[model samples]
Target: MMIQMELSMLNRNGTLVSEEETEEVTGIHCENLVIAFAVSNSPDFRSIRIIKTIKMCSHCHTFAKLVSEKYKRQILIKDPNCLHKFKGGKCSCEDYW
Candidate 1:
């Protein structure tokens, strides 16, 4: 599993936030992971599954959605918070997680 420190997240209110009151969350950066996966794996393998220990950052989540649409592939990312399926320029989380 990939990991990185996250400076922000969305609270229950659906607002973008950084947990300054406590500390920044740490998580995987899916974009770089996906790029590396693509580089190491065959192009014929269109779908991918990633198991992460923490939540995904917003930028990487958006990138996953865009990349999945552009490449016409399915990306399934399972993190501590939830499962995210990225395809057709969208994520199953709908940008909530």
Candidate 2:
């Protein structure tokens, strides 16, 4: 399910790359992929909450902000380190994490 979601997201965002070019899209994390999939498929949802086991990287954080802004949805991501609330292309962390 996760793999499918990632593939779908990569395809939709035109981020899918060949083996040698994988580094170019390293910013596309699992959380970002899942959230993108959920948002795209569930139009009725106005907000999204995600629990991540590890601390989210800066790229994932930025991705979440972008997703929230693009979808006009509030996104709450709780990782081991902190709670990140994203809305209108901004994150509660202020890019600290």
Q: Largest TM-score belongs to which candidate?
A: 2
lDDT tens digits by residue: candidate 1, 23-72: 34445444445545663564634566666655677776877788788777
lDDT of 2 at 44: 42
Clashes of each: 0, 0
Minimal lDDT window, size 10, model 2: 1-10
Find the 10 residues in a row with the least total lDDT in model 1. 19-28
lDDT of each: 0.66, 0.72
Error of 2 at 21 (Å): 19
TM-score of each: 0.61, 0.67
List clashing residue pairs in candidate 1. Answer: none
